[model samples]
Target: MNLESLLLNNLHRFPPRVVAWIEKRLKAIPSIRQKIDKEYDDMMGGLESSLKPYKDRFPAFTELPAQGRDRAEILREMEAMQSQEEDRWREGMVSGAVYHGDQAHIDFLNRVYALHSQSNPLHADVWPSATKFEAEIVRMTANMLGGGADVVGTVSSGGTESILLAMKTYRDWGRAKGIRKPEMILPVTA
Candidate 1:
């Protein structure tokens, strides 16, 4: 095992208060803080291209147009782009994505998705169906994970919300144990 794995393993053996004290002192080190910032910037730089593909190709709008663009024209541009771009994913030329590459299945899913395009589970008053679907998914997941009938789960939009929730849970647990500060040590592999 590397130095990080060894350090993390040892850290977990300490009480939470001791771990928090160590982390605070470690963060006070200039070199360690600088290295963390540099690594974070590098990771975000690598993700930027995938997240903002159309930033260079399409005209950006800070506000809506006085009138929307023509539906037919917008669709034609989208279809053209899709035809040229989709082959990469469909042929498995992309990483971290799964594609069936079946046109019929894709078409059926597109139609089904379009039907519910306006749904937002967060606003149950407006989108009761989406709320119901999310509830059912959470219930099924809880059961599959061997949680009892009283166990509850929530469906978050993505990684950011899920991570936030986990961090909050840890913070609350630490507070309950009389630790004002919480520190978590996750394996580098995780």
Candidate 2:
């Protein structure tokens, strides 16, 4: 029921100006605040119901003590889900995120993923395989540029963070060099 937290949680998915206007309008109208609360409750209830289609199929959490599910049983359930859901993505029916839809390519990636499933580059000593994979990925990317050998960078989720990070880095660099007003010009083209 915390409005501020809810707004901030949803900020990335919404326009900043729209969020600001909604916040302002909600604060201005007492009735709107109550309406927003009711809407949020309705939305949460609908989402919860939609998520748990097998609510009655599985034992209720309240009825059973918290315990780990058997590993084989868990894997069986996950494999069942993957079998049920793989067709849609495999045929490229979805809009985004799915890359290879062909069964052969999917199986190839699946096998590669399974091979490196236990590898975690976070601990290079424990998983040198992961470290090597990451190193080669970066190395190949760097090789594409004219300055092939010296290039170094990390992969990120998308352009938003990359732009933000670049801006912050430039800001810091400018400040360090005693620039009074550090401003980067943005392109006006849509």
Candidate 3:
């Protein structure tokens, strides 16, 4: 049997620490290490082409350019790149990338973003509108979800941030309830 099969069949017989030690020793062998490296390199070589289609077409900068490129030229390059990458998401061929791909909706969002591009919500004194917008959004969402006046939430930039905020809130709530250790069970997929 191959090394993988041998390990898979026998790993359960040993403790986790013993299995880890054996794995480390096996990886330390020159032949085993070389074989593993070759396999990893081969896998990555296959993936690189698909992952970096623009690598050959676009100019990659390892360091800052001595002189800045023309604004029009940079915009043209960016537009071309976006056009090349957007088709799949726009066509609904991809999942979880573009939730709303309608042109009118996109244009409206673009206009809103342009208006508030320099507005930082952290500086609420300077950007009171940002705070108002976030509060309205949270209130509207809570109401829509059947939340009462006591429900509260903060707007997060994305999924990871939302998850982190939720976890912190739960931990704080647990602490207030005199729970010493707050534990959460999350799905494997999450």
Candidate 4:
């Protein structure tokens, strides 16, 4: 077999820490580092156009203006940008972007957001209502899922936060069980 294929076939035989160290050493080589950097740059260059379509069309503020812009003008610009970006998701061209795209559902969500925009659930003592809302939502979800009274959860802001929280919980649980090293197997997509 070829050297590359042979090394890859046996790579799993090495300890993870040793493999990581080897990888770090290989990346330290100037030629290898340059090739990796070039690959990253090329990938990002191809994505830049789609990722920042409004970069040239809209103004980007690095620092605050000496004087604040008019509120109405700012709102107009924001709404225009939002309208442009929301089209793909609204038409269902983008998957998972909008779970429910009905105008009435969006309007109702917007109204609820407006009502609690300033409330921070982290400060439960100050915003008990936010905490109460989250608790009720969690309880209802648990009941619907056929969970017993022992099933409890906290509300996460999004999928990423939920994933992070779950990972931390697992890590803590492993440690409590006297596991010195904890490893997770994740799909390539994750």
Misplaced by over 4 Å in model 2 are: 1-28, 49-68, 91-93, 145-147, 155-190
Q: Flag the better candidate by TM-score, 2 or 3.
A: 3
Whole-model alpha-carbon lDDT for candidate 3? 0.90
Pairs with backbone N, CA or C atoms under 3 Å apart (clashes), candidate 2: none
- Using lDDT as the yardstick, the better of models 2 and 3 is 3
Residues 1-190, candidate 1: write the lDDT tens digits.
9966787879978998999998888779999889888999999987897777777887777999999899998998788778878888877887655546588998999997999998877789998988788889989999899988898778886776899998888788889999986667878786
Give the runs in model 3 whose Cα sits over 4 Å from its true position.
1-3, 9-18, 168-190
Model 2 worst lDDT window (10 residues): 56-65
CA displacement after TM-score superposition, residue 60 of candidate 3 (Å)? 1.7
Alpha-carbon TM-score of each model against the true structure: 0.59, 0.57, 0.80, 0.80
Cα-based RMSD of candidate 3: 3.0
Give per-residue CA lDDT, model 2, range 62-158, as digits (tens).
6655678789987887787677667867677777557656778889998998998887768989988777777787788788765567777665556
Pairs that collide in candidate 4 are none
Q: 52-155 in candidate 3: lDDT tens per residue?
A: 88899989989999999899999999999899888877777886757888899999999999999999999999999999999999999999999999987788
Rank the candidate models, highest TM-score first. Answer: 4, 3, 1, 2
- Where does candidate 3 clash, by residue pair? none
The model with the greatest lDDT is 3
Model 1, residue 150: C-alpha shift (Å) = 1.8
Root-mean-square deviation (CA) per prediction: 6.8, 8.1, 3.0, 3.0
